[model samples]
Target: METFTEASWYEKKENSIVKCTLCPHNCIIKPGKTGICLVRRNIEGILYAENYAVLSALHFDPVEKKPLYHFYPGQGVLSIGTFGCNLKCSFCQNSDISQNGIRDPERKALTDPQEIINEALDIKGNIGIAYTYNEPVIWFEYVRDVAKVAEKAGLKNVMVSNGFINETPGREMIEFTDAFNIDLKGFTEDFYKKHTSSSLEPVKETIKTIHKAGKHLEITNLVIPTLNDDPVVFEKMVEWIALETGENTVLHLSRYYPHFKVSLPPTEVKKLSGFYKIAKKYLKYVYLGNVADPAMGNNTLCPVCNSEVIVRNGYKTWTSGLDQQGKCKNCGLKIIEHI
Candidate 1:
């Protein structure tokens, strides 16, 4: 098993330094050091992905668990994630793995890429592989390798990302990835900088890039109270999604809970409902997440006739309202695809 694969999208600098261009951070690293993403290291002026083919978590998950409602809803996906992340979000949900890389080096298993594809093949009703859990952008080399094999094996690839990637790598991912659920952390630049230790523009660009490519794209905004829950800002964000990624784009307004560095109260269900209404005004498909209320924002209603098209209870989904073509049975409005 190769522990360190030669990383792509990097340049050697003078005095044994290397510049990593995988993400917008473009970290300049000295020999034996790593970039902002702890997974990629600079060894003797050569960049290597330290977490390449390293499996931290692997499971069979509902595609809705990815919170991707429209892309093959109710189907399962072989989900995998390595350690390390590009941005240091204060309220990171998966801070254990994203903030800290493999704690026990000996316990880290370097599984072959084909092994993952084989597992996906063995799963019943699994649509494909989901590069998720931690930031997939940091695990670029391994993801690309697996995606290539998965594609040849007739498996779809879904990326659950922060979308803070550079143009070259982002474009490369679009070629192989079939769907994306990008976390649009916040609407304002200040919020992104203060809470996420990143910026807003690159994520927006990545969303637009994916949308322009005609790929399945969904946006998830974890609404944090007193941070990004301002109605005006939320509306602007919804408008941006509608204008940039078409009104039909799926938007999931997830409730934020106190986690990691932040100890704020859980996002009010009322706030999520308000934002859901704001989003529904612009986007055709809007759903709320992390809230206990199932009836509020769990189902998909047709834009034309307000008829239930897809009903979801947690991960359990039933498309009873749509025919074989994924259109609303009430008014024949095309609600979703790849059903």
Candidate 2:
């Protein structure tokens, strides 16, 4: 039988209704009903995390694949993800796992937190663990337990999330997390409401909290062709990021493709280029993804000398122009977060 662990960040209400405090949703779940995340359920009067120790996918991937360019440039991270997500995104690339409330027979596996930490130690060149693929925030209990153990063992912890988590849990998790790649879906609240079924404010809050906590932070904006490709809106988003997060914040403008629900044509390279140009206006570091533009976007250049500090081809990374201290070898400017 699948063990159901009582969840944290929830308050019992009248007649067995429980309010989930993990995210901005604050889903008031009744007895036998699950939260919007589909992973946290109210059994009688207690909130239980349904996906505890349940893994849908696990792999040793380049840290760069987390799209975290500024943190440990060429290191490997053992990425793990489980079922369910807090938000309902129409263009969700991993909806099969993210939306699967119950464990799928072929994809589900059960492993204890210590086992996961051991797997991280076994992988060659692995710097640590990355809670990724599906929304890691939905698998909060498992992630929190594994992260605590991983940190004690001196392994770094990274979170690749949509940044919808609430303040209390987010702060607690950030205490153990070393870095994050937050998905800033779009600029407008309407964009978030219409597409992701979540709000924009909470995500911004999550980003600010992580940044203020002194963790290495990166942001990714998936550019959907007609939905969120407006130049004015895109520029405003980049400007806000630069002002609020810092000019040095690493941002990735990713091309969108037809996925789970949205069937619009793939985002154009020209749109990405335009957004990239706008971002470069205020941000010190920005990159393009999904579409190939090797000379223009994939490689990282020093802000001071314009020398290629890190060369990236797909998941491959070469840190040739970065010194041991992670400074620009040519101009001696400190560019990345050095481990």
Candidate 3:
């Protein structure tokens, strides 16, 4: 039997029930029962993070693989994730790890935050650690612990998340996180409710919170066929990002593939290109993912002079056209984040 870590961001209530404050779910867990995430349980009026020290997946990936275009373009990150998620999305790409809560005793036995830091240090050219693959918010305690250690070692911390966390915990997490890739599933509340079983307002709030904190942030919208691919709705989303998150906000429009339950046809390249045109109107930095055309999505251009500054070929990024200060060498336009 795997033990649990006492969780933060929760409160005790009457009849030994505990209300989880980690995310918008605010699940009121009864004694000996779990929350909506299925990984946080209330035991004698105290909430415990059941997946605290569990590991579902671990690997080293390019920063671009996180789909973060504006933050440390070519760096590699040590990505780690545990099982459990706050939302129930029908088309979850990583459903095996996200939907199923951590249950394997063997996987839990190897849970060590210090080991993560050590492994991160061992990887050559590894810039930092990324809490990714599954929803890192649900693994809050473990992430916080590892991040604290990683910070002291001068390692950057990146979070790949759904951005559904409550303000209190979200603020705390951002303190230690250097960069973030938040999934803005869709533009409408109905789309969110029907497809993800979650609301949209909290996600928007989380984006604003990250932006206001002055952290490196990027947004990914997995364009699904007939679900969130409306040109008008996508225009609204782009406009909102420009107005609220600013024009410099990095946006990635990803091509959705048949996955999990919702097996819609793969997004057409033409449709994604159309969205690219719409987003380009309001955003300074935009890219497409899961597509092969380098000219279409793998290069970054200077907003001032329209010169390609960084060229990326499936994570093998070349910054020859960018100066040491991340400026366009041709016109000296500051277009990327300096390392």
Q: Which candidate number would show the highest lDDT if scored against the true structure?
A: 1
lDDT (10s digit) by residue, model 1, range 1-339: 246789999998899999999999999999989888888888899998888877788999999999899988778999999899999999999999999976655544545888889889999999999999999999898899999999999999999999999998999999999999999998999999998888999999999999999999999999988988889999999999999999999999998989999999999998888888889899988899998977779898888998888899888999899988888998988878878
Off by over 4 Å in 1: 107-110
Decoy 2 TM-score against native? 0.97
Candidate 3, clashing residue pairs?
A: none
Better of 2 and 3 by lDDT: 3
The numbered model that scores best in TM-score is 1
After superposing candidate 3 on the true structure, give the runs of residues whose Cα lies further than 4 Å from its correct spot.
none
Instruction: Tell me the deviation in Å of residue 201 in model 2.
Output: 0.6
Sort order, lDDT high to low:
1, 3, 2
TM-score of each: 0.98, 0.97, 0.97
Local distance difference test scores for all models: 0.90, 0.88, 0.89
Residue pairs in clash, model 1: none
| Model 2 lDDT, full chain set | 0.88
Local accuracy of candidate 3 as per-residue lDDT tens digits, 279-320: 999998999999978668769988899888888987789888
Query: What's the CA error at residue 311 for candidate 2, in Å?
Result: 0.7
